[model samples]
Target: MRPFLFLGTRAEDLAADGEYDAVLRFSGLAERDLRRVRLERDELPPLDLDDWSGIVLGGGPYNVSDPDDLKSPAQRRAEARLADLAEQVVDADFPFLGACYGIGTLGRLRGGAVDRTFAEPIGAVTVTLTDAGRTDPLTADLPGSFDVFLGHKEAVSALPGGAVLLATAPSCPVQAFRIGTRVYATQFHPELDVDALCTRIEVYRHHGYFEPAAAEAVKAAARTATVTEPTRLLARFVELFARR
Candidate 1:
């Protein structure tokens, strides 16, 4: 079977590694089946969709909506590269799943309004599947409403044009959406668990997702939350898209 590709843009080693591990674990993909590229350190290489089963973009500190002056050179380069890649992925209608930052990339491509208006704090939140979500292959089998971990400074303020709204939350209306049959994005972090969320909360404490002083409290809340449903999306993606 062709391996899946994991693209991440985190600059911090701990957070980056944790994100990869979580995706690997949840997707039930062996290390050899999941090839990871840290976009923070390398440019997105020329991709041939035939070489892989699918692509997964993980969460990161980079916000596509950030002002140009505030973005790092690496962020700028990665964004430009991803912008080009987004076109290809959409044109091919390739299988891709993006969590957190992934929503921005796909959302922007479809002319969705990505902004800070729907930012969610670090914690678990209830996500209700839309009628479309309940019928879509990726999310169809899941409960109508379930808890998921999410913490982002920006989210899709308006639904992307021609994109199906899959999930919605009171804090963020555009919790998840799909473009074409094979492309997906979520405002929440599907790969996170208690430990992963705590690690991110600590690593990004100063990055302003929340009050730095409340980091421990935030972690404590995550520790007690029951979040076990979202990972199914990853497993289902692999199940539905893996090729022989």
Candidate 2:
């Protein structure tokens, strides 16, 4: 295996480290099997699917639902670059696991309607898997319902043409989806756990997932909620994708 590539975009250094550590812990991947690429102050070489076994994307404060006028030039450039990156991932049906923000990036590329209509604040939510999602190779071993960590202001309103809706909650109709055989996306944070999420709530206190004053409450909620089931599913995804 070449390595599992991680692409992250969090302007804050604290947020960046939390994202990186959560992914590594969830995947249970050895350092040799993972290569993280931060897009904030780094340049990405052209994506070559042949050289990498899989790609993973971490969540951030950025939202695809923001209006173009509100986006800075750098943000716009990053979006375009991600689009170009997804082209190869989609065409090759490259093994991919995108959590939160990556869901918007991949969803937009696949013709899914992504907006603020279904935003879930910081907490754990119950999710039911669709029949197709239940049958997906990555999710086959999981139960029909499970707890997942969520903190976002946007979600997929409608799945794309060729996508298989994997999971859903009453608040967010599209919690997860699969593109082709290998590409996958989750609106929730499958890489998050109680302690890890608490760390994030501290770093993202003002990112607007919650009121600046309510950050402590959010952490308390995460501490009491169950979010490990989803993280295990994410680990299984990376493990199985390596077999293809």
- What would the per-residue lDDT of candidate 1 be over residues 1-244, giving only the tens digit for each residue? 9999999999999999999999999999998999999998997789999999999999899998899999999999999988888889889999999999898888887667888898888999999999999999999999999999999888898777799999998889999999999999999999998888999999999999898999999998898899989999999999999998
Clashing pairs in model 2, backbone N/Cα/C closer than 3 A:
none
Tens digits of lDDT, candidate 2, 104-177: 88888656788889888899899999998788888877789999888899888878779888888998889889
Task: Report how far off residue 101 is in candidate 2 (Å).
Answer: 1.1
| Candidate 2: regions farther than 4 A off | none
Give candidate 1's total backbone clashes: 0
> Taking the candidates one at a time, how many backbone clashes does each contain?
0, 0
Error of 1 at 173 (Å): 0.3
> Best-fitting candidate, measured by lDDT?
1
Each model's lDDT: 0.92, 0.83
State model 1's lDDT.
0.92
